[model samples]
Target: METNLNNQISEEWTVSEDAIGQRIDQYLSHKFPEQSRATIQQWIKQGYVKIDGNDTKSKFLLKGFEKIHVELVLQDRTEHLPQEMPLDICYEDEHLLILNKPVGLVVHPGSGNPDNTLLNGLLAYSSEQKKLVRAGIVHRLDKDTSGLMVVAKDGETQQRLIDLLKEHDIKREYVAIVRGQLSHTGHVDQPIGRHPTQRVRMAVHHKGKPAITHYQPLRVFKHFSLMKLNLETGRTHQIRVHMHHLGHPLVGDPLYGNPNRIAADVVSELKDLVRAFPRQALHARQLEFIHPITQQPISIKIGLPEDMEQLLEDIEYYDDLDTFDDQMDVEYVE
Candidate 1:
């Protein structure tokens, strides 16, 4: 290993007989366990790695006893500025923070949204969190999906939390209003892929990754149902895609649901209420995970936001009316 006085670290590795026919990226990935193989491949592609003093590609096949040199510089990710904003913190400790993110709050800065995000707010909240990448965000909730998310206070905690998520050790439950009545507990086990033609949507395809959603009907209404959902895997838009595949897309889901047709299913008085819904009626209602630092368990539960609560009330009212009409019809027949 060699070290420069500046912020870069340069190291050398000798390929053993066992590593003879491996690709350069694979060899380096084995050498450095902490860094992701994708990161290492990016570094190699950018000419940060050399085999026998010559710049080589990631797929360069190695022979035994070849000397490989690597130069690494910690990534600088402070391009985004911090902004002062209010946060709905659920729990906080030295290692992590659990918070309820409200609707319309983007989790991170993206192409259209360059600032004023949860990441920006977290940066302004604490200096330690500011230094970490993406404000130490471990997982993400869609901008319209309001609910619990955990943020790490440091890098180690962030990695551990990520590992825990990959292991499926973290538990997440959601509450959503979906179209049609579902009376029984259900599970959706399907593969999800990007839409073939519709780029913004996800669909079920054989080539896609495995995704599962478990849901139980909390309340069956006239045209819509309140559901309690548990996720076995957290793929992008997993619940939305699975529900849509089941022919019962989430209420108010503009991308995958029949938002426009929702008004037609309800009565004349409730059409306006259905049409006025802003976003998907999905909320991360509960989150349970083991603490990375404290080695303790944590569980959090949040109630439905006011808009969803109002929507449920409307569903119940219409459902009651539907039941009454059925009863009246039965009496008339008798």
Candidate 2:
């Protein structure tokens, strides 16, 4: 648990002879009162704290004075606290805004991702511009899905975008890198709903929502394939489920893809890069729509994030997935 200063991790400390027979979490509490005892215990249970370079539960008892280490991951505590995170903004106006959301940036606040979302950053940006948005977020992108996304600044704009989306006036096109070499063109017209047995994942449920994805092979890599995707109807996990149903899983999709499939050499030295490759490799490259107020056509394009860029650069590293169908296997572990 040695922390590297250059990496902004505080140097870890060890328990001294003066502290012995103290509970692991209790000792941590005594040292870091700024961090709550319960929070420390929770982090320990989440494997944030390591005992002798091994994972330990929060209640793991301490025998005696030991060279124990503590590594604390930062989490936001204040309500509506704004962080100045760098944003790749592509377009902005009085009623709407657009940006190239980098991979790993969650769109909205959720269970664990309350702070540091694109929403939080937008809120901060709007505050200075004398604007606010309590609602009006037209659509969402999964935390790991990078690319272009639009946010409505006001209620009227939001409603207009929603209507446009319903009427298929807003065209959202995505470029994805999947694990297999696909055909020149294909469409996955599958009904997607909550996976019957695996409630956490969406699948091609018999009584699912109508979902269709039109895909065209853009570039064929050795072991990977870049495909252009168009959504006929947007549902939860539409592209992911449709592609998976059609036997193509996005490269880094943690929930759907092979857990052990990523190349180790690409991110061998970067632990965060390896772990950060947890989300699906999907990016909304293009967003086109007619302006609600001006009625003018608006289009925006975003480039790949650093990780995706690097991943694409290393495509030739692996041999082409020639027997992709024969070797491809789908296990329903949802």
Candidate 3:
């Protein structure tokens, strides 16, 4: 291993006879246990890894006595500094933590949001998270979409959780209020990708990654329905995009939902309330997985946040009123 003034690291390795026929990325993962295989693959794709003075693919088969070289530019960690903030911890152990993330909290730092994100808060909450990638965040929720999230406290646990997600071993359930009434349970098996023109939004496209969401109606209202949703595959803005694709975009989804979709007969007050909803009416309601360290099954369920609860209550009230009015009209005609 060698390091220069620019903080770039260069390392070399010689393949042994016993390790013949191993994939380069797999071999590198074994050598650097702390780094993820995905990261190593990215390094290989970027021409940072070479075999026998030739750039190689991550899947390159290794032969005995081949010289491998790797160079990586270290990322400066100072940019993501710790910021003290409140955390809604649902469950915590030495290996992992289950958090109930609230609405309006950014999960990570990005272009406009350079600090004061969940990552920064995690850094303040646990110094050990600094050593883990993305502060041990295996998956993510959109800033306005609040719900449960699992965070690992160590590298091995992080890798295990990531693997569980990849294998769909983790069970995640969500609750949402959508713009249209649904009478039956259904599932959306579609693909989702970044919008062609709208860079900030996601859309259902044929060329996108495979995505699936199963949904059941909990309560059907005049113009809205409360839904129970489970993710078969976690894609970016997946539920929102799929629901939108079905023409029942989630209530209060600023990007994909249309306020005009509300039923004209819906009481004026309810219409105003629905239109004024501040964020997507979606929440991660449950999470279930096997504990990496304890080898135990873990399941957690949480109720709706205050705003969603209030909105649901209002919808129920107005829907019942509409029903009563219709009953009265029929009786009068009789």
Predicted model with the maximum TM-score: 3
Instruction: Flag clash pairs in model 1.
Output: none
Q: Per-residue error at 62 for model 2, in Å?
A: 75
Among all candidates shown, the one with the greatest lDDT: 3
TM-score, candidate 1, is 0.76
Candidate 3's displacement at residue 226, Å, is 0.3
Q: Please, what are the lDDT tens digits per residue for candidate 1 over residues 50-158?
A: 8898888888898889888888775644567778998999999888999999999999999899999999998889866754667789889999999999998866688
**Which candidate model has the greater TM-score, 1 or 2?**
1
After superposition, which runs of candidate 1 have C-alpha atoms over 4 Å from their true positions? Answer: 1-76, 263-265, 321-334
Candidates ranked by lDDT, best first?
3, 1, 2
- For model 2, residues 116-208, the per-residue Cα lDDT tens digits are 887777666755322233333668888778888887765556657877988888889998878666756879888888888888799998799
Which model is ahead, 1 or 3, in terms of lDDT? 3
> What lDDT tens digits, residue by residue, belong to model 3 across residues 1-334?
6868775879998889988999999988888766778878988999999899999898889888999888888554335798999999999999999999999999999999899899999999987788688899999999999999999987778999988999999999999999876757889999999999999999999999999999887776677878888998999999999999998999989889875567778889988999899999999989998897799999989989999999988888777434433322121100
TM-score, cand. 3: 0.78
TM-score-sorted candidate list, best first: 3, 1, 2
Candidate 3: residue 196 Cα off by (Å): 1.9
Candidates in order have lDDT scores of 0.83, 0.70, 0.86
